[model samples]
Target chain A: MLKDMKELFKEQWEHHNLIFRMAKFEVKGMYQIHYLGSIWQFINPIIQVGIYFVVFGIGLRGGRPIDGDIPFLLWLLMGLIPWFFISPTMVQGSNSIYQKVNLVSKMNFPVSLLPTIRIVGNSFQFLALLVVLFIITLLYGIFPSVQLLQLPYYLLSMYMFLFAFTIWSSTIATLIRDYQNLLQSMMRMILYLSPILWDPMGDRVPDWLGNILKLNPFYYIIEGIRSSFLGGDWFFEDPIYLLYFWTLTFIMLYFGSRMHFRFRKDFVDYL
Target chain B: MAKVEFKNVSKVYDMYAKQSDKLLDLLSIRSKKSTKQFWALRDISFEVNDGETIGIVGLNGSGKSTISNILAQVIQPSSGEVTINGVTSLIAISAGLNNNLNGYENIDLKCMMHGLTVEEIEAVKPSIIDFADIGEHINQPVKNYSSGMRSRLGFAIAVHTDPDILIIDEALSVGDSTFANKCLLKMEEFKQQGKTIFFISHSAKQMKTFCDRVLWVHYGRLKNFGAKKRVLGNYVEFTEWFDQLSEEEKKKYKQNMLRKQYTVQEKTKRKQADKKNKWTAFGHLAMFIPLLVLGALIVLGY
Candidate 1:
């Protein structure tokens, strides 16, 4: 088992750099066709944020402050930043294998690399949104603290979780194409279900409901980020939750790797 | 040196019809209406040593692609195993390429797919671009490319990867004579470099020139695997006999195929119309299902 783990890790490392390059190429390729080009990456998301701020923040009265802490706009932006990272990462990642059926079948390389590329691409978009988040936070006078140093750890946790989920979804989607549609629906549900736009603490829901909400890995990630930036106490302070998150991530990673390795050989036949 | 071995390998495909067929089959309560198993390849075994250029020649549906796929590790044998000593690249030119991606991005993606790092891809990108020779259209989507352009780009990328085992599946035929010659030269260079090549092509002349050995497959069975001249000559003889069949014999052959493919009643109509137009028979048989159900019900007093 130790030897297997070592081999898997080595393979992952070798493929990771390739994934990164492909991801960058995909993002660049997307921009190449349009007249506006790479500017659209910045422009497109800003437009989306602007529309959300106007509709959800102002029009739907989401603009009003919630939890008597962060402004509604600021709260929405905070959640949106992570969601921006999570949703696209998951959705695109889920469909990544199916979309690249051609590459998966003909190439002898690891199939896990394709979904990794999708996650990496989404992460770049997340970084762009992070810039926007920083600008907004600076304007609001919510400056970074020593706790902000912990941002990398939180981001690492989020990355691990997203990677695990992407792998799981990519593998599952290859077997059952309906899983892609299911993923889109689930992501849409999670957008509202998770405490992205609303604070579960403020809503005062039943204990069982809140407990169930905690079961969501994204909930922990979002809470972890909120704790770091918003000065909220560490929601994941309990070593148990950290262990639980990591354990689940590892399990998913194992299953994902197994699925990719097992089914990869027959993918061309199906495709 | 790269070597590939398929030991006692077999592949069986479980053929399942759509949901409607299942529902109808269930309603009819017939076991015959259920799924079927097709063995595309069975108990096939072969080994190709390093630097051996083996040509595979076979009629359509003779498991040529299946064998190539297995060698490329694109598909596993249902039974037994395939072991490879080095990196294998399958030049399924059109199949592996993303039509939506431009030529440059496609090459980059292909490089990445072949397990090249970013820096490595960047370094080799210029050579791939120059070799493809598609001009500025390299920035355009590959879907817009003609078949020749796609083949050129694919061949260029595959050649640049420097694979230890290169498997080509009828991709060379897409390009013009000039480009095809370039591809052949590249294959020759790969052979000189001691790379294992499994080439599948219908062109007997090309295969004779390039391959040191030949594997002839017929109806998913290996007919011969030996020296190119001997095996290919035998394969040509077999095809010649098939081609010499009379029109009546051809009709009987097609009818036999239809019987194996369709239900009993559909087979009769297909056999009857085989002489006139086989396609018309298929059209009639396609519509015969509903009409047959009605006729059978009336005759049986259902």
Candidate 2:
């Protein structure tokens, strides 16, 4: 059943320059037109956190401690940063092929790179959010630590995780369009399920349910971020979750890419 | 000497009478004969020597553009092999230009697509801008440019890349006569450089002036491909005859083209089917080994 994916990788290698340029173009073109331009990168996420805070932090929890000792805003912001990064990143990453049908069909560039372009595009925006996240943490009196370097390690993990997910989501979303809507609804559900707004690890959430929430591969990312930011634990401290996340991600990525190779030629017709 | 060759290259689009047939096809449950097929091209075989200029002439939906697309490697042929010897570029109105990007950015984008390095793109940028001749508007978004200006930019970027085989599909139709002539002069320079040029156009005069040979396609079949005078002469005669046909006769003419066209050639069908099955059956797991390889690499620090 196995084809020479080494060949597929070589093909991707050949188009690395194209992917890099397209990703760079996407990152630049996104914020170039507006008056606030690059400033919106900072404003958009802050406002998103504000709305979540008003609704969940203040409205629901009355702006109190969320984790055992962490304030609601700190907990919420750490969770929300990844949430914001992932929600649109997946949504847009899934739709990247449908949106750039012209480029995929008409140009000589690699169609597989479409998902990567989206992932990279969102990563740049996430970079901005990352800087803001650190700033807010610093303001709250958490001094920088040796563990701060873990941010890049987690960033690489998020990229690997999302890029892998995107390989599947973008390709599958093209074949079965309902996957996009399904994902949209699922993202909403994921928000509730993944401890974005609530204390899934706290006593309010049952121990069994909280343990189950950790099963979500997406939780792997947010938990990694929180662990790094809070200096609670190293990524390898939880080896089972790491293994589970990698297995789930690579399998989805494998299937996602298979769909890409099989259907890439037919995409223009489908569009 | 064969810069490009198509040996029995055919493209058959699976025409689903009902949209749900696509799903059935996916499940491999649909009977072979139950699915209607529309062949965009059939048994197309030709070879273009280095520096040869070939013109493609056909009515709308007659597969002229399809030929250009296949040769440019934009799409794969359904069955048979396409051997292209060198870098190919296709120029058409808005073929690959991103609407959101400015003209200047589009040059870099297109050049990058051609796999040029940063220094290479920098070296060619000035020439492309000069060739396009769109002044201050170059800084503005391409979506704001008119159709004529878009073609100018597309043509400029394509020709500047020094492609070994250049295919132009109806892009010149939009530009003004002066710009079209300017393009022709540039193409002549490419011809002198021993590059293969495929020109697809409705203009007989343009074909006569630019093309050394002509290929006439009719209803997805190659009617004739030879010296421009020999093929264009017959194609002109056929169109003239068609124009004079009475309304009743025209309907019969179309019917005649479709008659005896559905007989499935087992060889081409089997090849396409085998390819489809191979990819669908194990295509996912095909990458299983690669994933394991990547997994191993990731577990390692680097």
Candidate 3:
């Protein structure tokens, strides 16, 4: 069994490029169905930003200020940018196996690659959103700083985090169909729990709750992006947080991979 | 040298009748219980060496699909082991290819699914396109294509994979006679190239022409497996005899067989089926209960 797992990993590694390309193909295939094509990727997120700004920034102006410096709209956009990256990737990633049940059953190939494809496909859309974010931020006078040089590192960390979580969700969701619904609810809860809309640092929450908030990987990731893009600080300055994020990412990846490898052969039977 | 093996394999499928039955069961509105367990295939064992073509001949629900599915690894056997030497491609033909994807993309995706690298897929793409011969329709989604076009594309993709073992389940029946002949020729070429092939069809003549060996599965058991001529000859005789039986004779035979196999529950089920007005009672209750309550309220109106 162990030997089989090792062989599976080796096969997955060798086929990683094919997996990535197929993932890109799946995204492209989605675009092929629509009249507007690739323009939707750019347009969708901007539309999301506009709707949220109107609803939350203007409509439900609850008089809650963000750090007393940043505009509420800007803060919401910053928060939403990461939330966009995380939510869809995780949700779609979780359901990918079930969605492609027929393909997995009929074909003999690496099954782990299916869920990973969801993450990679979503990453393309996320990149489009990033370009839109950059242009919007630039217009708002939130110019690039020296800390902007660490953007690549933050992006890498976020990708790693997304990949890890996707693997975890996809594997578990295969056995328990309800995990997809559970994940959506959890994401909604976490969206409010994390420092996405509110400033964790500025809030006078209890220290115990504050400490718990720091433990969420999204808190670090969203905060990491906010620091680099908004507050202008290098990501690597806090080695402890970086270590925590990487360690958690690796743990999720390891277990997720192990579950996938263990269950893949029997997947068709269940499907 | 054995390319495929099925040893004492059995698959039992638990079939639930429908949601209506379940709802009746939940509401204690039972007519006759409709759920049952069925053994699709049982104690099936066979072996085929490399470079041999074997054909499975059976009627519908005779476990032909179940055997093919097990060989394809699409579903696991309830018991026993199936061992194969190299990559096996089981093209149910109708089941695998996506109708939403265009022929070109379907080819690409199928190639990727079979573990072909992108460059390798690109190298073979032209030949596959040429073989499919649907011309400009290859660029359109497969849903728009005729069933013959779908078969052509499916056959093209399956052959291009260069499988060590090829399993075809009712694929050749779809295309026109010309395309079917072309497909048979391709299979002959693959057979000559020393690949193992399992062909499933209801046509006895086709099996006699194509296969070195014939396997007859009767109600999930291996009824016959040997040289094609002898096995098929016996199968043809048996089926002919079955067809010639008189209605009364067939009815008597069926009753005798059922009597031998039926359980006490089955007997009770038959009795219940004769006695029940379950649906009518439930329907009347559903229609009259509201009216009855309304009439009572009107009589006691405040």
Candidate 4:
């Protein structure tokens, strides 16, 4: 098992350049058919944020504030940016291997790199959305602080967690078509279940249940990014939650790499 | 040293009734075993020395493509040992070219996948384009290329990659005779450079002229393997005799050979069942062990 994990990492590391190049090509290809080209990446997210801001911020919250001083739109933007990155990645990453079976099967290509390519490809759009979030925050007079430096830490955490999850999910989805559908439904469920749209920490919800909801890994990420962007406690301040998140990630990675190496040789056969 | 050697190589494909059953069997949860198995290659073994141009002759569905895929490391055999000494490139029709990417982009991507440095790709770019002869269409998406044009680009990229073992699987059949002649000349140059080549083609005349040896595959088994003169002679004679048969007789002959290729013995079936049971049990264990460890660790609070 250790050897398999090592091999997976080493393969990705050795092919780092190729992965980046492919990711760039994929991001470009996604918008290639459109006359607008890559502009749609930003446009789609901005439109999503606008609708969510209208419905949840104005329609639901009555243009109120979240957690006292933070305006509802700013708070939603922080969570929505991360949520936007995570959502499509889950759907697309799970289908990455099956979608590229024709391309990868023709040569001695590393099938595992497909999910990473998906993540990195979506990161381009995520980065653009992130800049929009930063600009909006700055406009609201939230200057950069030491807490902002932790943004990278949270971003890396999100990437690692998503990588672990997608590696497992993509392998399962490739083997079982039903699982892909399950993943799509599950992502929709998670959007409502997690605190992206509604604040679990609000007065309407009880503290104990909200704490339990924080156990959801996405909750940890969304809350972490919110805290980093808006100036809150250091990530190290919450040792237990930190330990829990990384433990879950490594555990997922363990199972993912195990199943990946075991079944990847025959993945084409399944197709 | 032998450039390529296959020791008792065999490839068996499990026939799944449904995708759900495939998942269940993979997770070791399926109650009933799949009864259908296709043996694409059965206990076939051969060895090739450096610079040997070997031709494979077989009727359709005789597993010639399977051999090429395995040799190219694009697929793995079910059982046996395959030792390949160097990089193997399989140039089938539009094998690795991405249709959405332009011709130049496909060349860059495929060449990069083969580990060519940027400078090296640049160095070979002109020759590949010149050989493919697609002209201004090189900037156009590959989906726009005709079948012949696609194969030309594929062939050009594979040959320029400088693989040690080149397997051409009917890629020449798509192009015109002029391009075919050009490829044959390039292949002769490869032979002079001592690179082993595996050629799979239906044209016996071309095989006779190009290959040093011939491998005759008859329904997943090696019917003959020897110098081109003897093996090609026997293959050509057999093909001629088989063609003279009535259509019904030919169909019956093919069905009989196919039946022999796919049936598994009761002993092997039982063995495979036991192995599946063990794997399923392991799958259950693997599924739970991680959650168990994670829960335990969280409880312990690191």
Q: Write the per-residue lDDT of candidate 4 for residues B217-249, one digit (tens) a residue.
A: 888998999999999999889999999999999
Tell me the spans in candidate 4 whose CA falls farther than 4 Å from its real position: A105-108, B265-302
Ranking by DockQ: 4, 2, 1, 3
- Model 3: runs farther than 4 Å from truth? A1-12, A62-65, A204-211, A232-251, B12-38, B244-302
The model with the greatest lDDT is: 4
TM-score of chain B of 2: 0.85
Show the lowest summed lDDT stretch of 10 residues, model 3 chain A.
A1-10
Residue-level lDDT of model 3, residues A2-79, one tens digit each, is 454465457758777777777877887788778999888767777987887777767765645577667787778778
Question: What CAPRI class is candidate 3?
Answer: incorrect
> Candidate 3 on B1-302: residue-level lDDT in tens?
57898888988654446645534543446777444646678788989998999999976667898888888887888778889788888877674676667888899888888878779999999999998899999989888998888888888988898898889999888888888888888899998899999999988987888999999987667889999999999999988987799999877865664343222223144335432477755653564454444333323431
State model 3's lDDT.
0.77
Off by over 4 Å in 1: A1-8, A60-62, A203-208, A235-244, B18-35, B98-102, B116-130, B192-194, B246-248, B251-302
Task: Using lDDT as the measure, name the better of candidate 1 and candidate 3.
Answer: 3
Q: Output the better candidate (2/4) by TM-score.
A: 4
True contacts kept of each: 0.41, 0.22, 0.32, 0.21
What tens digits encode model 1's per-residue C-alpha lDDT throughout B1-302? 33888788877765556744434442444345335656677677788887899999998877899898788776778898888898878887564577668887788788877767778888999988888889989978988988888888988998898788888999888888888898899888889988889999989999999999999876666778999999999988877887899989977875664344332221112134455587755654664455445433433434
- How far out, in Å, is residue A4 in model 3? 9.2
**lDDT, ranked from best to worst:** 4, 2, 3, 1
Q: TM-scores of all models? A: 0.82, 0.90, 0.81, 0.92
